[model samples]
Target chain A: MDMTTPLVEMREISIAFGGIKAVDHASVDLHAGEVVGLLGHNGAGKSTLIKILSGAYRADAGEIRIAGEPVAISSPRDAKRHGIETIYQTLALADNVDAAANIFLGRELLTAWGTLDDSAMEAETRKVMGRLNPHFRRFKEPVKALSGGQRQSVAIARAIYFNARVLIMDEPTAALGPAETKQVADLILELKKQGIGIFLISHDLHDVFDLADRVSVMKNGKVVGSAHVRDVTQDEVLGMIISGKCPPGAVAGPGALRS
Target chain B: MTESVPAPATPSQDAKSFADHLRAIEFDARMIGMIAALAVIWLGFNWLSGGAFLTPRNLWNLSVQTASVAVMACGMVLVIVTRNIDLSVGSMLGFVGMVTGLVQAQLLPGLLGFEHPATWLLSILAAVALGGLIGLFQGALIAYLAIPSFIVTLGGLLVWRGGAWWVTQGQTIAPMDSRFRPLGGGIEGAIGTSASWAIGLVICALIVAGIAFARRRRKRYGFALRPLWAEIVLAALACGTVVGAVAIANSYALPAGVARRLVEAKGGTWPEGGLTIGHGLAVPVLLALAVGVAMSFLARRLRFGRYVFSIGGNPEAAQLSGVNTRKVLMLVYGLMGMLVGIAACISTARLNAATNSAGQLDELYVIAAAVIGGTSLAGGVGTIAGAMLGALVMQSLQSGMVLIGVDTPLQNIVVGIVLVLAVWLDGLYRKRLG
Candidate 1:
């Protein structure tokens, strides 16, 4: 297979907070239209790696490339400018505000008089929701009143509305029930169909198998190995996680993971 | 081809009734409790005064006394609605009074050379404008500079008081323009005739009716609306009380030449009933009403008000939403400063002097009024009407206590207790809602 060019490639990304190395020379790459699962246990530097991409945290040393072109991403605003959007675990939704308001918050559509143009915003929200998940109908009620799946839909709508090309989801299904999780998975598929690459950070291996095209495992601030979902078994991935070495089941080669 | 549909759910129906029942119970409890408390207070005062509290003349005096603080409390309500306090209102009022006094007394005649013939009109205009400017300054600093309002306005209380002292050289500026004096000093027309008093009550009724109807229309149209019937009833009761007191005042007259002679004998101790209701109502009541209405509009209709609530409820969330939280904070404090300025003006005008000790301990009353009226100290829920009522209650206690010859120190203690009780009750009510 040709590893010709990736949509985004982070080369040896490292970040240290105070004296602790949160991420140490971790590398990740996503190809166009690919769902990449970043699987790691707690404190395995998975979130830090993705946050570096989303510009929530700046890498102490590394190069991150979008479309194979090197670029600087030092802030979330910078990430957005570079067409990278992150949906945090908290969803960052204002509960008291309606779905339309939640979607357009911080970047509201204003009228000629500089006041919020409610109709225009609501219309835009409806249009975006229809494009992503046509089943979502609760637009007028506050996000706090919305179901978990509906709230997730709104968060996805916000990211997509900003014309994000690379979406990074931090445990999107962490707080959701099974039904809500399914909806989020379907949303991931839908986004992939539209040619948007996704980096899904999750501890759920089942979810990785069901959704991701490629699975990259990180153990102790390092990428252990990456394999296509069809080529790697659950046991093999678990072995790599436990022993930090590629098992015989890995496709890349024997001894792919080394201590 | 017909599949038997499962029976429609009954649990949901039961829940709907349950929720309705709960809401009704909550509202009834609040209304009944408030009414009972009011009744107890009235009866207690009546008994203490040997039935003099219910006498027409004393009751009229209570109504008159309640009006000023009630009006000021209206503005205080909005200020607190945004989860802020205006501790400097008394000092600010003193300063405004000084300004009004200086201007109307022709200390600044060049500034008042205008088309308007009435010096009082120009003086009030200047005072209010100054008050608004002070508000803007305080708001800008609190909202933009990210200063705590408590510190900024505490500093303002001292600054303005000192400024007032400096302006009048720590002396009373007295013998204000006669036209201005009546705005805080009058009774009903034709030696206690009830006509003017009746007119005043009718106007109050009309205002209350207008507000209630407007609110009802909004609620009917599915806008976020307040409870209409409660408001209307409150307005009606308040208006009726005022009117009844005025009618009672009309039934009696102070002994002829008593008030004039008292004023002549002691320059400061003017006997009651010398001035009529029409002239006296304009300054304090009108000032308070205008401030209250403007603030209500700001809180309900303006983006700024919404931001205040959002910030108060959750500062982090508000910041994420791009609300300029710092700017909003400053602006709110500044606005409080300005309102205090207006209050100062009214207090000074009423006394017809910018006395050094004119508004001592008055801030406690206003703040207590706001708190008792349900302006949550924790922030994010309050109303102009509630604050007004709170002020009215305090003023009532003050007037009634004085009539019964209660010691001033004890009166303070009583009012302080009432404030604590009101807050405690509010806490319990909120807990029930939870």
Candidate 2:
């Protein structure tokens, strides 16, 4: 891989449902150690576009390259195999199971006897959760009994546990309190320092400005524009999101206002 | 990230209730509630039947009667836990039993000679395979075709029942192979006194070892440990129950005539009082218990079981986690069908006959057992041991009513009311806990 090659390159992805386009020729790229904020209104195809990358949905047309190598991700399992992890907006934790079970939901630790190594998994869970949320003590209780912040921590712990190279966090702070939100922001910075690329999808511009290195705005199922976070002001990005108007410092996509 | 770590909060020592103490010991409130209910039912029935209900003979007979339903109930827990139901188990059992009977009686006799030892094993394997195939067929329709499980199983209920009748054109097949007859409990079916005691002792040893192993594992991980005294008490209680059950089974002696026949056949003279041959543990009861243990292991320790519960808890979440939800659902149904096959063998062997009406209304009883055991119909919760106990409870009620000479119609009405009442109470208990 070239030193300047992007860690992830999603080029011209499109998907439609029932003749209605959910994502239209959207493109985004993330460099190593960079955070790209995906900003859009609800149903702006931001989630749909990211879902294709996470293997939750297949694009009607697209090319996704990892470390400059083209790869096919048709399932969540496939995405995980390529070192991609996603913390869904809903958290997606299995409510009736405990933290350990949820953290190792698909990728479980097994004993030599081919049974679930629950104690080993629990110990690993404690180690990860200690780093993420040190006050967490209810290791035996189901996730349903946990508070929102605790559950969010569990989801975050799951995503980061397996050394993901490209992490996709959809509305990571939506359900969190201010303290928890700050903790997530810190975690993003911490992950970035480790040279991990992240796609942070959010409706909050302040969150985008605070954590993201670059910003990609989507509107009406199409990418409106892209720019460095330092180059584009919040109001200019807002204009790009609301009216598909590209700022002077941003590169306009096909969906940008034709003024 | 900040370097300073906050102190972990300690639980308050004061104001702990008895329930809180139980929780501290990690006792499942639902399991205790079911046990208490079982005790009440057993005591009440014994009183109503002038103590006949508590007799060794009656209890042993009850265990045998519960075997088939208990086996199916183990599978039902997984099905219901996955937010699906198998309404066709009873009919599938009937059809599978008919096929097994036909194989052993008409087909195996020609191929392997009459009363061949291997006939029983082959018949059982055939039944299980057939049952699994039927279950998979229904599961495929539900998972792949996008049909609701309720509709698919409802159709299966009719189809399998008609198929059962068609197998023998509504005729009853009887006089199963002598070797196969022992799968059901009879004088010949039991393991006898010495074996039961040996098995009981081994189980007690296992219980103690399991507790010790768990404690060591927990300590290794620095997880909170139950008080040492609590662990000892739990192990003692479990071991005591096993020993007591074995004693009860051992106390049920063979009838005088049968005892005399056995002694005479063995070239020994029968005494004036005649020899007492204890019934010990019946084969069917042992089979049911084995199924219970295996099912519990699968549900608690296997990846497949985890996926089933996860899907039940949240289908989309499980899917997003890379779980193959459809395959898991299909396998659950297939497992249920295989269990139904085992149940069919037991019921057929016990009756020494396979009838079209065999296992009729068994679906309701199996579902009731699972529900009464605390399996939620909405999904994501249940246990195999609880379902087995639930089967015992149901069997006790039916036999208790019979011993007290209650009319059949009245018995059905009472059972129906109890099922509804149990679920209502369970709902209330869950709400209170919440």
Candidate 3:
């Protein structure tokens, strides 16, 4: 194990359900202060790979490393303990609980008497809201009363509240309006400044170009190539996703490091 | 051509706060509607009976009679809030009453040779414990085995009722020892009744004030609170109405000794104890109130309450959030059974007999009260106050219809219509909110 290794190194990970290989021989590295854009067509193993990282699925073969030391993650709790958090598309929030309660959902702060310390939870919620610079109040009642961006703020706050050092966000800005999207984008920048690595899974090339520091393209359950964001064009990435081969001047131009 | 930009508007800050104020009191619309319905019925009854219906004695009688079902309905509200129902409460009540009767009548004389408070306490404890155990068994089947609570508790309804019958050998157990009767049977003279009413009203006022202050403080501290003035005004109105009711009833009771003195003046027989407080106002009413208040606090002011709401709102989401949904479900059912036990104690005390059929069909009334009180059958929303109001409305219709000489069959039809209308109105409210 190298002390200065990247935060996450997934090597030769493979997962199969009843002999159908959903994810096969995939390897990727995500380092701190870097955004990894995972790109692939739908059902091409991008989500499966991300789920393995988030502990929503187990790999049949391969090793997952956190800071160069191999670790086993069998559940979402395990992932949280390893400082890895996932923000799913559904956002799995209890709609009746207010923003503060949602942010501290499973790990709510408790008073000396073991009751939910609502005041402290509110204070902490406010502090995190300040950090995100969200455009809403935490005490505006239930999450059902919140707008899209406000709900996203709550989801983000939950992950961060638990001190997630590696964030795997599944389409954070998918259904958001333009202003809401910009707010989330700003939140991502804030998180990046705090030196947390992000694995942003998306189908939008525009978001990838706007926010990714590095892009790893997956095709047929394998990482075809990985490169600096500046080294690839949207057209080149699209071509690789469609053809399983890189275009001219792309990171995998001619003979990029063979997998 | 450039896009013309309007002057940057200050962030629309007050709009949300203003909207919140408009919608804050909206949550209690069902409560208001139910109260209005009750008032309209009372006025109609008064008109039909030519003001006799509004007699203080009758009103006091109504209150006492409404208490038993009202208290049971409070617990039912919490049970429904957790997306569960206990159809076996009536059956549980019968069984518990049997336990109470057997303990106080059959077992106490044979074992202790004398009855004391402890004897009654033990009986009550045994009844509650039995109810709790039955609830726990039902909850386990529902929560752990993933069986439907409806089916489990429905089975429980038949099982407990049969158990009650078996325990009593299909006989009515009677004559609860006199020592344990005062808590559920005693009534006072006009002065004592008035004093009790005054004390009860003061306690009610203190409670209302505490709740209002806490709500206001929560809102002031940036937590959600309804409109402050509205809450205070509602509380004050409720207290005033109760006190006024008590005073008016006391005024009509013929001034205690005057009735007997007038009879003697007319050369007629004089009654003992100077007429005995105008129908004695039933001890079960106070007991019911005490039970209702305690249960309401449990449902509203505790973490257990929040858990019930959460599980009722969405069990799957609650589970994923690590809420131990099964345990919560179990606890709620257990609480419901214990409440049914309390109701059994009151009913047994009121009747002075523990018949095998003591609480027959009573669960229907309690459940009807909860549903008519705006508790969603799909769950996640209800209130003890609403349940009490519903029970009063139901009981009032039953009593007033009988008083006004309506046929029992016709009364049932009318009550059925009211229930349907209440449910339809609730559905409309939900649709509008949606």
Candidate 4:
């Protein structure tokens, strides 16, 4: 529970699919109130590594420790139980249902009669949504009708409402316009103020620079290098991603990221 | 959790402008379309039948005829909503009917020395359970084993139908226990005009209360709602339809043939003319309504229903949201199975016999009803009420065409065309909404 202990510590995770290595000996971690940016090109195995952490896939070899406590996350439920929440690119929403229903799909707030407590859920949704996106007003439409930013608000609201301490946002701003992306950035900054750690996966160098405190570059299912954002230029991080070589005189080097 | 959240939007806040009021109100557009379609179909058929179609006798018969399909269609809505189809339901019905018929007509007679009242109840329960068990088996294969629902149900269709035939060597089982007849709206199954009115009124009351509670919740959540007049109009419309249906059903008097037989059986002289209001509400129709209401509640008011729709809408998203998609799929199928059992009992009781082909081609009709009533074949969008109306529309078309003396082949051709047209219309409606 001490601030010095990283919020999440994943070690030497490896997973293979059909005799091909998707992720091999990769490690990533986040500290309290910090954003760890994971950057890699397609097929670089960054997503594969994150999926393992999100409990969508089990690593064939690895151990995950949260706040110095080893844990096994075999499913999305297990991930959530460990206070981890994922906002996938698809937003993972049921477009036919309104916001409140989508937010509480599996974990619905129920009345004494065991029926859905729609009012309570909606009130909570309104509270979280208002904080995440100040001008959001389409309360009745499904997440599909919401703009990219508004949809992100709903997803974030769901994750935050569940008291997520470790939030994984995958390409959240990828589809968003500049304004919406900025809105999401603001929301993430506010979340950081609450001491929640975020693992942000993005291809946009600008997003990484704007939000990340540390950048971890993955190439061919391995951590190319880890560096404090202030210590390495964007080109150096790009080099680490493309050639799997760490730049000289970097604050964070391979194996040196181990706490 | 933040001060950024605004004060609740009150009704008066948006009520100042009519367009604002209008824009704020969101209702199920598809449901309105269904009501309109059903009206047009009813009127068109009445016109085609030269008034015979709208008569109390024909209308009452249509309600009863729609029962089996409507009952199955309610469950089919849930099945279809969860991105699955149960093509074996028709065959399942035949299988269940065979089970019921075998027990009540053959096994019970032999075991108890004659058909007993309790035997009928026991047979009904067994038949429904068997239907559910069949559904669970198929659902498990699709959900847990990763087989497609189409394949599993398609195989079930053949296997269950063959099983039905195998059960009795294709010989018809007849003369169900006398007690079973009432449950199927046989001669003794009518609830009478007064009871029909009573039940309809009670339903109306419940519906109004439900609407009021919903409105209150919406207001509390600061969500926009339809105007008071709009709510009145919708409630009155529903209430009127129910009352009108009951009245029409009551107007059909027992024919002279039935009246004479009843008087003879009662050891009373038949008057020169005695009018007996046609049995008001067929028991099967009532049962269908009950099933429809219960299923509707489950689909709209419970966690299970929400999970089913979310899973159908987006399985990946549902899974990530921690929904147990496979379990929902299995339970949905299991529920569909139980409804099939109820439908089987109704079909058997109505036929007063169980034949191998008892529910021949009914899967097509049930699916057709669900699709036409607004359940999307693609899944994630459906309503039990709409499916029930869809059943009514299809049955009306079939019965009206038969009354018009259309050739059986031509009748099939017309239904096929109508199904295509209805689906096409649904697609267009969705596109327009988008």
lDDT of 1 at A126: 79
TM-score of chain A as modeled in candidate 4: 0.93
| Ranking of all candidate structures by their lDDT, best first | 2, 4, 3, 1
What lDDT tens digits, residue by residue, belong to model 4 across residues B1-434?
12122455765774456434445454466777787887787888888878878888888889999999999999999999888899999999999999889988878889885757588788889888998999999999999999999999999999999999999899999978888877778557787778988998998998799889889988987766788888888788888888888888777776678767877888988777675756788899999999998998898779998899898788888888888889989989999999999999999999888988989899999999999998898888988999999999999999999888899999999999999999999999788667
DockQ per model, Cα: 0.13, 0.51, 0.22, 0.43
Error of 4 at A188 (Å): 1.7
lDDT of 2 by residue, B1-434 (tens): 12222343446656667777888999888888989998998899899888999999999999999999999999999999989999999999999999999999999999989999899999899989998999998888888788999999999899999999999998999889887888889988988899999999998998999899999989998889999999999999999999999999999999889879988999999998667889899999999989998999999999998999999888888998999999999989999999999999999999999988889999999999999999999999888988998888888889899999999999999999999999999999888776
B353: Cα error in model 4, Å? 0.4
Of 1 and 3, the candidate ranking higher by TM-score: 3
Expressed as tens digits, the lDDT of each residue in B252-287 for candidate 1 is 555456546544666755546563221222334544
Show the colliding residue pairs in model 3. none
lDDT of 3 by residue, B47-95 (tens): 9877877787677667766776887898788788878888988888998
**In model 1, what is the error at residue B189, expressed in angstroms?**
12
Give residue B374's lDDT in candidate 3 (0 to 100).
Answer: 84
Q: What residue runs in model 3 are displaced by over 4 Å at the alpha carbon?
A: A1-31, A37-86, A107-138, A213-259, B1-27, B179-198, B201-205, B208-212, B215-232, B245-283
True-vs-predicted CA distance for residue A130, candidate 1, Å? 12
Better of 1 and 4 by lDDT: 4
Off by over 4 Å in 1: A1-88, A91-170, A187-209, A212-259, B1-40, B43-86, B103-107, B110-122, B125-147, B178-283
Note the chain A TM-score of all models in turn: 0.90, 0.98, 0.90, 0.93
RMSD of 2: 2.0
User: What is the CAPRI rating of model 4's predicted complex?
Assistant: acceptable
For model 2, what is the alpha-carbon lDDT of residue A249?
Answer: 89
